[model samples]
Target: MGVEVLTVSSKGQIVLPVKMRRTIGITDGDKLAAFASDDGVIMLKVVKVPTVQDFKVRLDEAKDWAESVGYKEEDISDIIKSVRLAKRENSN
Candidate 1:
């Protein structure tokens, strides 16, 4: 794609060209993460924020997999503590 100049409106918003938007697969209501660098570079990235339902679905899937693998809920704390201890020892 060639370079396309964009003009910012008085409201400090720039309209992404339809062609560019289509190429990048950006749609309405999508969230964008914007970053500005010291070198005057600006970037926008599409980011997904999981909804409560999405998180619940993922949690349910994880629970189902853990149950299928015979992992009980009581093992989580020990597993996390062991991982943290291992990480602390490795960092030292």
Candidate 2:
């Protein structure tokens, strides 16, 4: 768990710190959910964590995990790379 302090702008917008946004992969045009806790604390959560250009990273991570769990490296790498390249093309 981590916390970041951000000053709300005059336009009533608070930019989540870059570190937080990048960590959560939230991007422009994405919707967030805001709620109030029982203790009167305002909470903001990403309603949908966007998959922007992050599929590559996820694929690499998954490959490592799967290999550790006894997956065949050749097959996993081929599939992951294909999907990653497709995502890159689609993002353009």
Candidate 3:
């Protein structure tokens, strides 16, 4: 577990300390999400989904719409699988 105490500054910036950031490999420009549990346990989660960049998301939706309109585009699942594998390697 992390340290049990933290300070929220007057300017509303909550600085995460060095050791916690080191454990997560977080750096500038990464996005984060904050949520609270039913029992009032507020949490900050590193967003892994956003780490998977939005490669061809709009194209995927367009493909689905095209198929619905009886205009089929060729399946590119294999290409996506390869790209996802490469991205996983790169993120690591």
Q: Lowest lDDT 10-mer window, candidate 2?
A: 35-44
lDDT of 3 by residue, 3-80 (tens): 334677999678878787777777888667553334232344456543223324534675688688765434445545
TM-score leaderboard ranking: 1, 3, 2
Query: Of the pair 1 and 3, which is ahead by TM-score?
Result: 1
Every model's TM-score:
0.46, 0.41, 0.41
Which one wins by lDDT: 1 or 3? Answer: 1
Q: Could you give candidate 2's per-residue lDDT for residues 2-91 as a string of tens digits?
A: 545467799978778878878877788767755333422334355556353444465578668988988785675576667778777767
Error of 1 at 22 (Å): 0.3
Tell me how far the alpha carbon of residue 13 in candidate 3 is from the true structure, in angstroms, after superposition. Answer: 1.4
Q: Per-residue lDDT of 1-92 in model 1, one digit per residue for the tens? A: 54455788999998889998888888998776553334233344456755556545656787799999998988877866787787777679
As for candidate 3, its clashing pairs are: none
Top TM-score hit: 1
Report how far residue 49 has shifted in candidate 1, in Å. 6.1
All models, RMSD in angstroms: 15.1, 15.2, 14.8
Q: After superposition, how far is residue 43 of candidate 3 from its true place, in Å?
A: 3.2
The better-scoring model by lDDT among 1 and 2 is: 1
